[model samples]
Target: MAIANESRQEEQNMREEHHGAGRYWLIWVLLLVLTAVTVVTGRIHIPTWGLVLALVVATTKGTLVLLYFMHLIDHRGANRLVFAVSILFVVLMLAIPLVDLGTRYRGATPPGSTVSDMQAIDIGADAMEGRFGGGLRKEGKTGEQSGSPRQ
Candidate 1:
């Protein structure tokens, strides 16, 4: 059992050490070229094809970033599970805002209790008239001052 464990450890170490430098550099160059291509491709018109191509290219970029930068592909199940849950939470957050926006015209509260009803506009013909005397004033039949209620 001890000898088998040693062999397994040695094999793991060897696998970790054998990454190819030239292929890694080539991968970096490919990523850069693909990014440039995505940018340029956005400028041209392709009608129905453009949307599919854009999503495909975006997914490709996401995959590369996930595998290399996020290290998800190389990571074990727990790390990937964490990523999945995080993505799910973000989707949930986005969905809530969309629901709120969609329900704007739908009645949530009593109709007459909203903001506009709280402050009804002053219907007095005199825009400059104040109910109480600052500049323009209004008088009752007994000639008493009524304060500006229009504002």
Candidate 2:
């Protein structure tokens, strides 16, 4: 019984050592502060200032997610480099909207024009039925059947 208890305690100690508590407390506090900032930014419609503040909050969250959750903070050299490259790719992804926005004066479709044709049909179920051609039995009626014991 004593040996079993000692083994259980050792296992618990090992688990604590392996996982640790991390820096989740600080992370959580930062997350909460950022959340508050974001919410406040939305409330005050200063337009110009609000946009900047929102971007700052968003960047903070991105950094936290990348460093903490994604484990990039623990790694050095190549891993960090890749993480940076991935972040750059994300920035490039975000820049696509700005690219389109910059060209907005060139007769681009305005915002909220998601569906160009509102009158588009919704024959989704019909599409499925037509796809199968009423299953294999329909083909049997179409004069094409496999070898049938030719007497």
Candidate 3:
């Protein structure tokens, strides 16, 4: 009976070790396939959808790395909650700039209009030209100009 029990225990240990190795190998293959998919998708441009697809692939890869490589999948309760909160903060940081961009008025600045106001400065033009001197100084107009030799 003791011999049989020892043999069974050894078999069980072998099985467990095999199973763990197989699982890690499978995950490695899957990660490689995902990397190939990301490379393929990146090379083929599909306009707006291209960026979206790349982001999806990157997010999937990141999640896989976090779960398997970081050993977060085996963790429970508080560890999972902390990771979830961290993801939420990351999303919030990305979302705030997008929200600001989306809420901005498209027609706020018309093309080829030189009117100086809040809109002109916001649209990235030289709105404070008068205070900074509009153009090149005349040759003999001022005492500072008279000191310089004219070519």
Candidate 4:
């Protein structure tokens, strides 16, 4: 009888732990919408503010996942503080590298390239040539397909 009572208590605890399928479905939809917004912003390329917008969207999504999917919303205060600190560490790690990269001089060779025999090249031109379907390389700055007359 004691064993049966313990099993019943375990089942009751599990039932109380669940917030319900409705809440989960709602969160799922919100996450999807945020993902779509991120995709759109990435493609549009708003220049200076683009990276900031993307980071904001990513942080929001991460917070939602942590609070809901990870069950951190109802977790103990100590656990929440630990998670927050870990997130702060991660942000610091990423921010330091970004800051260093942004402040670096143009055309300066990156570290580890010195070990290689290869020399530096025009990164911007190469990237633009690839992205514009070879139009920039084949048709100058017009970006039109070669052998086709512009209307």
Candidate 5:
């Protein structure tokens, strides 16, 4: 009876090892698929939707890696809590810059102005002739500056 019980326990352990390998393989395949999806989505230009789709795919892949590859799936309590907090901090870091950029005034300077020109304008200086060396200056006129033919 003791020998039989020991054999059964050994068999159960072997079965569990096989099952674990299978689960890891599945997760690996899933990660590969998500990577393909990411590459495909990255090529097509869908404006804001492209960014959103890429983020979703990346997040899915990341979660899979964290849960399975990192062996966090069977873990609970403190481990999960730490991971959740880390994710929160990452999101916060990304979001802060995006929020600042989104709220910036788009019309801060006139279009076609260079970085130095924008800086000069911000400091309340006449950057037009200063940077261009006082050439044949004409506003909204056809030439190298305006590109469009003069009316």
Candidate 6:
């Protein structure tokens, strides 16, 4: 039928739009150059904008892979819309946890130290003080002497 033939023609046109071996080789070489840039950025510490530059390079590489290798360029608009939405969700997922961690209190507890170490550091009445700074009024409940805090 004419409809079947038209569909085949459209499919052929889509195939033609796909890049040839030369185009792929060019993209591959560009990707290699970007990779070299990434390695150089990793070696030298730029402090402020180092992470930003690395992210930009990574995003560029990802975009190239998606557009060419994934064949998203010749795909439907809906496919691109779906991809964009997914990316937005991924960003939101990473950003929400970062916000939570950023707003939290820093160094509330001693890093990698035990309770015995804390007691050794500050003994007697100071050791009896709780995490929130309230000293124990009555002790010996957990099998210590009639007076004094837990061991």
Instruction: Name the best candidate (by TM-score).
Output: 5
Evaluated against the true structure, the overall lDDT of model 3 is 0.65
lDDT tens digits by residue: candidate 2, 82-137: 87898788778877885775566523554344423234455565554355443222
After TM-score superposition, the amount by which residue 55's alpha carbon in candidate 3 deviates from its true location, in angstroms, is 2.0
Q: Which lDDT values do the candidates have, in the order given?
A: 0.63, 0.65, 0.65, 0.75, 0.68, 0.70
After aligning candidate 6 to the native by TM-score, how far in Å is the CA of 106 from where it should be? Answer: 8.0
lDDT per residue (tens digit) for residues 95-133 in model 1: 687567546653443344442224445546554464343
What stretches of model 6 exceed 4 Å from their correct place?
1-12, 16-18, 94-151
Please state the error at residue 57 of candidate 4 in Å.
1.7
TM-score, every prediction:
0.41, 0.48, 0.54, 0.54, 0.58, 0.53
In terms of lDDT, model 6 sits at 0.70
lDDT of 6 by residue, 47-138 (tens): 66785688778978988888877777776656688889977886787678756654655454354343122333445566454544665644
Q: After superposition, how far is residue 34 of candidate 1 from its true place, in Å?
A: 1.7
Off by over 4 Å in 1: 1-18, 83-151
Output the TM-score of candidate 5: 0.58
Model 2, backbone clash pairs (residues 3+ apart or across chains), number: 0
Candidate 5, which segments miss by more than 4 Å at Cα? Answer: 1-19, 108-131, 134-151
Model 5, 1-151: lDDT tens digits are 8657765766576557534488889999999999998888878877756766877788789989998888776555566889999889878887897677556565654544431234333422344434544433345433445323335
User: Which of candidates 2 and 4 reaches a greater TM-score?
Assistant: 4
| Runs off by more than 4 Å, candidate 2 | 1-22, 49-52, 106-151
Q: How well is each residue in 92-118 modelled by candidate 4, as lDDT tens digits?
A: 987998787676664554644532335
lDDT for each residue of candidate 3 in 1-151, tens digit (9 for 90 to 100): 8657765766576556533667678778888898998888878877646756776677777888888777777655556888899888877886787577556665653544532224434422333222354444444445546224445
